[model samples]
Target: MQSIRSLAARRLRSSPSSCFTATPASALGPGSARFPMAIFAAQLRGIKASSKLQQESTADTIEYSKLSDEDLNEGLQRETSESGARKPFNVEYLRESMARRPHRATYDFLSPGHSHLLNIALWDALPLEARAGNIPDSPQSSASEETSISQFFMPSASAPANNSDHELPSGHHLVYFPLQRPISLLEPDGTDPAQSPGVPFVRRMWAGGALDFRRPQNMQLNGARAVCVERLDTPNMVMRGGWGREKIFVDVVRRYGANVADLDPSPSMTAPEKLLALENKVWDDADFEERRTLVFMRAKDDVPEEDAAEAAKKPKAEERIIKSPREPEYSFSFTPTPTLLFQFSALSYNAHAIHLDLNYCRNVEGHRDLLVHGPLTLVLMLSAIRSRNTNSQVSPGRFIRMFEYRNIAPLYANEELRVCVRRNVQGRAGDERSVSEPSARWDVWVENNRGGICARGTAVTHV
Candidate 1:
């Protein structure tokens, strides 16, 4: 099979007009007369170049050159439908694709190393007071000993063979990342395209998510293997700002449980049958469940020259700001640095350019700087709740049972942001809280330095 580089080269040689023209020597300045022709000859002499080289070089080339004709047509149909044209949107196709579930389950080991590294990264990002009781006192202790994660690494007899001593933390499950796509398969924005609603709706953002620790004790750090079964709900169309601007919201549900192989052994089953059985068992015996809402919208090209100048004149941080109305009973402020963002990205195996690439964030996403990851904010909220519980004598043994959160706005790196939590009454009248069960509800949010809430959530805890 011919590589894309060879195919591009062959096409360029066959169609010189599509690439470039050999400039006359008289058109060039002194000492650079033969530069263009020489480079052109070099490219023709089997010097490999990317298929996108010519397209990227030309100003008028279509931005969606990577997409197939069918994909382009589908996107065009959606655009026309949004514009009140007779062509209807491809609702059937969207429903079929988005609602499909994975055929096989993905597995990951509950490695202590993953937990330890995440703990270290979170410790560095936390304020001094938040890290006060969490870390050990001895300066001479090992790096692992300085964080609470060290306790999980200790040996436990009851732990699954080769697993850690303690159960995984509330939000530490983020570290057990999903399957990653190879660079060749990733979108231009450095995101996995498997779940994307194809073509023009390529740009994706983590809009919000929820976590339910139904049986948290089942997931431990003992190096035992666990399985995750994922399925996507039907996509919902949302109108944003004006009439022709549409966004697609996709809800991804993942259930984590012990690997079925370890629990049951059926040698007579075929591979596909075994996988189906495993997925069914996981759904029934899941230790915890996570649902992430991702929003996909059309990609924005660079602003035109005339508008670019005007946009440059305005301050990057001069957008609308909405402050939180509820005062916090506990708050911790810390600025996320580039290193912290990079570390978190690595821990989560998230290659989204918004978190790791500053240029992509500014030039493509129109952000002031690198954006803080949605999952990172969730982790911070969990950390804040854990810290509050650790310091309070009333609920020392309380654990987070359920958490629901939404991302309201973007939070930039190197900006001071505060994680705030306010305690609320346990439950409604005649509910579980009205009984002897000691529980609490907390309103948790993260606000920027200007006191604008960027992310907010609610957490329910039980003793």
Candidate 2:
């Protein structure tokens, strides 16, 4: 058999530059320029190469490093064909599953108590100095205010029954738990398998999501009724690594609107008609539109044993750490305790084993400890943005209009997590006027203790 290096050299000598061109450091932007070419190739194809490959191939020692993108994909396709052509899930079943949708709109009352509990949980998780501006004086004077507390938390005044004075803070809607399915309906990982592709593609991760706040004032925390209309888009499958490492991406779209009976007050409306009208109204006049992208992969056992062992042997500090490109205008560090994770899981009604059961995390998921909820990181990023705005020169009246984020890696409990926010400067270097205009666009990220950016996002604000 030909040695990997020799084969690589032969390919390099025969292949034209057009077949494989090295991406320039400038093209990759700032911090990403430090990554190896092999890593870049992996990222370009959305393939997360095993840590063993990453560790073994240093800047000076990469095997088959000059393989063209086409060559790599061809090899993957060849391997897939050789693996017996059996699919994990039936395509017909998947199509049937995608065709199904909830017939009625689900409703949840905007409870101040739920938001208050989340506020307290987050406050307790932050350091004393980090909590400086988030103190609540009254129900309406808490974090969601433009001036007083952090804009991420609901005011204490809103916590009382029948209080509809305060608006629900951005990202606080996560606490208004979703309707739960029967215990027997949950997947082995403790996730609701309602919209899942099927078995074997069981392990789920929140890959990324986007939130659009159209009318923030309409989503009040006044114990008023609210409706959420959810629908699942068609799923797309991608070959992340190889046959066994395949991943399915599912997009969930949720629209939130106030459940006011005045929309259609005809007493003659039937039950189904009322529900249909409510859903239509929610979709047409949604106060908040959210898109959540979830990626599902095979269970840990399905991964090659060699790869799993190599991952287990790797030190946490040595794991791939992607640094932030810009310095943060505001940064806050907080260590997530087991109790904090439990509280957040309870609040979100997420029973995922990776966030709760240590044995499952270590033995099954191959994680060192319980993982932090992905949505929790999103909340932290939003909070950091609000906190930075409170202390910075940005206008207090401005609110987050659009926010989008991607989760790159897992964050574990008992580890220090830092939320960083920086003002986004647009336009060319000579254009000071554009760069200095209140920085309506912002860059936000969450960093682990090792300086690895586990999650990164962008936020657009409007006055």
- The candidate maximizing TM-score is 1
- Candidate 2 per-residue lDDT, tens place, 126-180, comes to 5433332333334335446455444445445444432223566678888773644
Q: Ten consecutive residues with minimal summed lDDT in candidate 2?
A: 17-26
Using all chains and alpha carbons, the TM-scores for the candidates as numbered come to 0.70, 0.69
Alpha carbon deviation, residue 178, candidate 1 (Å): 2.9
The reply for model 1, stretches above 4 Å from the true place, is 1-92, 101-104, 127-165, 235-244, 259-270, 302-318, 390-398, 428-436
lDDT by residue for model 1 (42-152), tens: 232224334454334333223444444466557656654554442334444454433332322456777556766676787667764444133212223455655444443
Q: Report the error of model 2 at residue 265, Å.
A: 12
